[model samples]
Target: MRSISVKIVIKTFLLVLVFGIFSKIYGQTDLAVKQKSNFWKQVQFGGGFGLNIGTGFTDVTLAPNAIYNLNQYLALGAGLQGSIVSQKDYYSSAIYGVNTIVLINPVEEVQLSIELEQVRVNNTFRNPTTGIVKDNFWNTGLFVGGGYRMENVTMGMRYNLLFNKDKNVYADAMMPFIRVYF
Candidate 1:
């Protein structure tokens, strides 16, 4: 089960990396063509990463997003995310999701955002007496929060309003994010 979890994580990471590289190349070409225009100038690339390590637990995440500016105050975007969590001699889990986001800037350096996401998660548990158990499910999440926006970077925090306490993979807690745009 542990080997399976690791294989899933590796495959997901590779797939994400491949897609990201392709997008970057395509975006560069698009930018060149729109160099003299202002419409393409409004598009931005950004994402967030997380890592945690402890005595017997570890969590890692990677999320990448692209945004299109609709106006001075509003922007829309889409993102893809993958995460893995492991606990020594306990459980290992893999999660992946897709999200659509809307961001509003009411004031300079301040941003408000809302996101809807659909996530799929797989968990493998190792038990002392029961041997092993595996579970897989899909869930929906609605997130609303605010953040600090800068010229080239943004930092934000959000809470999932629709988080399910019983079946969801993510905890019903605040999540922090940082993104860099080009």
Candidate 2:
């Protein structure tokens, strides 16, 4: 699982790099002619939705955000996120988080983004040995990541760089995301 995740990340980064280079070469003239807009006109609304289902596992996530275009090249935004996950006779969990994001667009269609997030997770586990179920304590995580962006949407991956394996509710080293803008 880890190897596959790493491979995907590498491929994504490479694709972004190639796209950036090509855009720079062909889109330089387009950058000089910047379109002017008002503050409200520069604001955008969007978010992400995800669902995963398997034989005995299910997860759903929804994140909504608002973005302000600072200029032709920079943008800032904030958002809220909520998620739920469950596994048959195993565990069920709920996650909530707040995030702030910064995006840089070197060209019209290509973007780079950095995001910081604080998340709280609550979990309930079923102990097979004791045939009992108990609720675990709440835990918080701080995550950061950078990724490639596109017009009206972004496809990227993130990781909890500050997580402690023993205590952190999030175990995945890399998580992919798809966000849309309206």
Candidate 3:
């Protein structure tokens, strides 16, 4: 009962946001040119990185991306993703991937996104009695989400449309993120 109502509220909130943003976008009355005249002026580059090292575990991530703003409302971009993670005497993995993204900013403070990603995962697990086991596979995901935006940064949550419990690296299909692009 409560959970169902929460979901409905969330959906309604998103609809309201989209409607407000669209109205603001089309309501512009300024005579100013809406797009940049120089191609180079529309390009931006940025990425995300993470490093975590503790007692017996280590995880490092690097993802670099570039986007070309088609105009005030649209952007198309691509990025590379890489990660090295290890747990002592347990497992170690190398992940590499590429992704393409489309971002739409109907209003300066709200952005919607769709991204397609393919990652190759190589993992090795150690067992005292079984020697070692190696697992390698490719995982692809299509993510659709939105975020609150401020300048070149956005904070949001995205859900993977093709998540499998046994075949996924993440524990859940939903992931929270803070994205920054210059």
Best by lDDT: 3
- TM-score for each of the candidates: 0.73, 0.66, 0.78
lDDT of each: 0.88, 0.78, 0.91
Q: What would the TM-score be for candidate 3 when compared with the true structure? A: 0.78
Q: Weakest 10 consecutive residues, lDDT, candidate 2?
A: 29-38
lDDT for model 3, on a 0 to 1 scale? Answer: 0.91
Flag clash pairs in model 3: none
Candidate 2's residue-wise lDDT over 74-107, tens digit each? 9899999999999999888888888888878888
| Model 3 lDDT tens row, 50-72 | 99999999999999999999999
Task: Please write out the lDDT profile of model 1 over residues 94-157, one tens digit for every residue.
Answer: 9999999998999879989899999899999999999999999998888898989887677989
lDDT of 2: 0.78
User: Which regions of candidate 2 deviate over 4 angstroms?
Assistant: 1-37, 131-146
Model 1 lDDT at residue 140: 88
